[model samples]
Target: MDTHTGRRRTDTDAADRPADPAFERRLLAQVERLIAERGSVLAAQGRSLADLGDVEEFAERMVAALPTRHPYDESLGPFYDTAGLVTWLGVSRQAVADRVRRGTLLACRTADGHLLYPSLQFGRDGQVRPGVFEAVGEFTRRGVDGWAVALWLTTASEAFEGHSAVDFLVLHRSSAAAVQRVVEVATADAQSWVA
Candidate 1:
């Protein structure tokens, strides 16, 4: 409820609210600038940015493709904070931090810079789903930020048979080829970031 108005908060209100129009554009502009700067550095080293492949189109498509319906879109969350997760997992705070730092656990930083573990990382048993550590490590190893990794994993892909990577991992846990395919896609995504 909104204390001042004595009314409940609803999805309708959220949908009615105006989103920040310039945020995505600003981010796109920053990425474009980064690509240009990278191109400059590569040129100095006798290389070309052409290898990145249609950088502008790639950036715009990614931004446009961002999922618009997640609960996170409404709130930046109470998403599995470390202290709470430690209780649930029966581990010390240091262990959780270590896992996140090592990329064995997926975590994204809030605007205020606290790491919040996405709820998707946990299964119904309160354990992390299999193959998560490997996938998270793959992205982090190649400079893909945690938030982007989380988004990529959640997005439905035709490559994963119209399912997200998480579902594919769960359903194909025993298939070595399937697991390897996930890793390969992660590597490809990393290559995009490397561009």
Candidate 2:
């Protein structure tokens, strides 16, 4: 019931009150028509909203549509280069060149081209003890992300056994200090994920 209009209104009409039914219907019809028209246009262009099922496809399309060097297309953090680092570290390479290229790790090549990293530098190329990797792998198996593993290893001051070598650094050091080193290396190894 509309007090001002002094007429009974349907529930749907009342829900859309203050809006004329004819106008509302026309507006909705127009919107639907527009959607259909646009959908057809997109289909003609070999694309459609229907094809975008999961977020991955949508994101892929968005990325594919991006022009070169767009800031939005770039990764924003230190761990962005983790894949390469993990590979190099696994291969027993010093990985200084890789880290330097990423610009997130810091080190100087010695006269003989040997890389020098401070003992406390987390991302610096160092031998990953077997137990350390096991500890990290345990954390990962338990659904821990890199941040959590790094946090526990660097902050908790506890020895862990896992398949990822990250735990070794944490086991031998206080978590706080280890975390600090991780931060330093992240900054120094910019874009280098290996460290």
Candidate 3:
């Protein structure tokens, strides 16, 4: 209500809306870069834009194929801070830090210098799965960063018969050798690119 004018106020003014030109510009730039990159990769593989059949389908696939990276400041998260982890694992904050230091847990540091642990490492029983730590150790040994390791654990890989490393781990909890194979194969491919 507009008490000063003695009249009821309604949301009819367009000027009340906030401007978002910066966000729009950033989104436009990212989309343009993705399209250009995807086009080049497709061309290299003998699959032209025409082979996509439809523009919308191609856009969908391109989005799906986009690499998953850590968004440092955004609220969209499956991440847990120290306090949350303490509660979740029924352990002290120091214990969490110790686990991270020992490479028994996977953690990503945010721009604010806070460590955020990926929720995927915990099972339904609130315990860190055994294979996750082993995979993290292997990734660390092969020079993979924590973010890439987290993404590799979650993302579907052809090496695992189209199943993600985490999925295979959950399905075959006792088979550490299978997870080791996936890690070795991925690490070797990454190294070959470096060579």
How well is each residue in 1-195 modelled by candidate 2, as lDDT tens digits?
432222234555445437578987997798679767978999999999677467554444333221221121122112212222333344323454554444333333334443332222243344433333334434434344444344443443222334112444445563655544544433333223333
Candidates 1 and 3 compared by lDDT, better number: 1
lDDT order of candidates, top first: 1, 3, 2
Q: What TM-score do all the candidates reach, one by one?
A: 0.57, 0.23, 0.52
lDDT of 1 by residue, 35-145 (tens): 789999999988897765685644433342222222474333235655446555657879988887787888887676766677766765566666665788888877678
Looking at model 3, the pairs that clash are: none
Off by over 4 Å in 1: 1-78
Cα lDDT for residue 44, candidate 1: 94
> Candidate 1's C-alpha lDDT?
0.68
Superior by TM-score: candidate 1 or candidate 2: 1
Per-residue lDDT tens digits for candidate 3, residues 44-140, read: 9989768767876445433322212234323223666555555546577789888777777888776667677777777766666766767676666
**For this target, which candidate reaches the highest lDDT against the unseen true structure?**
1
Q: Indicate whether candidate 1 or candidate 3 has the larger TM-score.
A: 1
Candidate 3 segments exceeding 4 Å error: 1-77, 141-143, 173-177, 186-195
